[model samples]
Target: FQVKKKQFFRNFMTITLFGAVGTMMSFFTISLAAIAIFSRMNIGTLDVSDFLAIGAIFSATDSVCTLQVLNQDETPFLYSLVFGEGVVNDATSVVLFNALQNFDPNQIDAIVILKFLGNFCYLFVSSTFLGVFTGLLSAYVIKKLYIGRHSTDREVALVMLMAYLSYMLAELLDLSGILTVFFCGIVMSHYTWHNVTESSRVTTKHAFATLSFIAETFLFLYVGMDALDIEKWKFAS
Candidate 1:
């Protein structure tokens, strides 16, 4: 994207803050507003905690769609913001949903809110560390084992496998798999990428791109088809 390092970092921070803190704030706002509106209208009674859980569920942004729309304009700041927010949003949604799913509205208090925020911060930081460490370890192993000096196919396979491995391990450890994989990708690109043979590097790049394009194409196609079902159309009305 040719974004300046400082600008990229600043934008990344902004989007990340939106993803984490912004999502939490949005959840609370939506919950309170929905409760107020419903109460005023004398609608069916709803649990505040349940409404908050719904808010968490909807906080997840589709980064793929955001990136696809923004990337065409060559706007690095907007692209970075959308991309970063989408990533963090997914992780935040997961953590927030899990934390609030079993929560009781009657137990709400200032101390509980503080503890919830504390848990979210801790989870975010720990998951990030797990991802970076996995990437670093993979890079170190590839360099020490001289995998790149071997067959290009083997190098490519090893790198791709390690990336998936990080995600799996993160899930096994009850960390945010999405964030772990995200950081793993960043680390692999920055560190391990330089260690690979030129042939393997090109191979990996093209392979990943082709696979991603195909995946996204089919994913959207399926979504479109799913949405066309008349039986499920009542929700929109």
Candidate 2:
């Protein structure tokens, strides 16, 4: 959402190329390489779908740290390209992973491939629309209800809850909750941000930043702990 609209449009093609097409290429490349290596190594046989799923999982890239170091004002095009690519890459990977989950090697055919493509399109489009709708609804509620005029706390709370609502609704419908919440945030920043009180805007911004930092901290901490778990290693051995 912080991305300039004009800049985003200007670099849209590049972003899509690197994001969607590149991710798919990476997924297939990784899957094929893994399959070849495993075959030669005589490792236990694994299904093609399993290898593709793993590829999809690892293909999603995060550009948060890169973007943090980038000066958006000075390098708006570069920043937008990287940012947009990261977003699309993640969405494409998730859609690909979900689509591949139902794949069967024995059933592989032109029709099955077409069906997979159709399902991917359906999930991507539906999830995007759901996110946009939820964001618009939140904006409408904040604008028409005048909650911010009375209490900034209610305004802040409403925005946060609505964001959560979008995620929950997406998950409930078996859609991509991450994409839903992402678009929800974008919409909220675009529309709902203007509807809220000034204090609420500042408060909400800091609150979300703090929450993000805490979440990242815990995520890395847990990952490190899991990696260092001697008992788990012993059990596997």
Candidate 3:
């Protein structure tokens, strides 16, 4: 257990460092583009707020349902590193976005710094704690219910339903709902049984991974088209 945790910590750090570097590189490239758009064309200047919002939303990296996939087996170290970093940065970006929107750069002070730190700690700890507690509770309920056991098909269905419901509960609570999904996977990890039981677990994971992929793909494609349409409409106006 200690060894695995140590590995987890090392993977987390390496991932975070790379994430920071990637964020810096992304900012630099975006800065250059912003400069070119304003100087080399008729595009007007943008304020700090614009940069902050864009930076916040775009800075987040997602690994889809990779955590579930990892729970099925020993995850490759690189996968752990990258995905872990991406998840953390997602919340950080959102928080930074909110902060920048609320206060101008010139107004930043020690109080603002404390507020930012407080926000991060609150979101991170609450998201994880709620996710884990709910996950464990749900798992215990499922185990005692005996509804999914003995029947492979029923068990897979039960897990899927529970995972979906867990995410919804987290969202309804105004928490990081996706983190709940991650915790669901983690709790389920503790319940892994024999060879046959393990296969059922993998099946459910694969199902979620597939569904999440399709959902993300269609959502992003549609959102991209909507964005383009808005851009064109703005130009006409």
User: TM-score winner among the candidates?
Assistant: 2
Cα shift from native, residue 188, model 3 (Å): 2.6
Instruction: Point out where model 3 deviates above 4 Å.
Output: 1-10, 20-47, 61-75, 98-107, 192-199, 219-237
130, model 2: CA deviation in Å?
0.5
Clash pairs detected, candidate 1:
none
Q: Candidate 1, residues 12-62: lDDT per residue as tens digits? A: 768778888888788777777777777898867777776787688877768
Quick one: RMSD of model 3?
A: 5.7
TM-score of 1: 0.83
Show how many residue pairs clash in every candidate, following the order shown. Answer: 0, 0, 0
lDDT of 2 by residue, 1-237 (tens): 356767876888998899989999999888889888888988777888878887899899878778889988999989989988998899899988887877776788999999989988887888888898999999999888854565788998999999999999988987888778877888888899888888888898888988987987788789899999999999988
lDDT of 3 by residue, 116-217 (tens): 657655655676777677667656766776666767787677766776777787677666666666656566555522222666767766776678669888
TM-score, every prediction: 0.83, 0.92, 0.67
Worst window of 10 by summed lDDT in candidate 1: 1-10
Rank order (by lDDT, best first): 2, 1, 3
Top model by lDDT, which number? 2
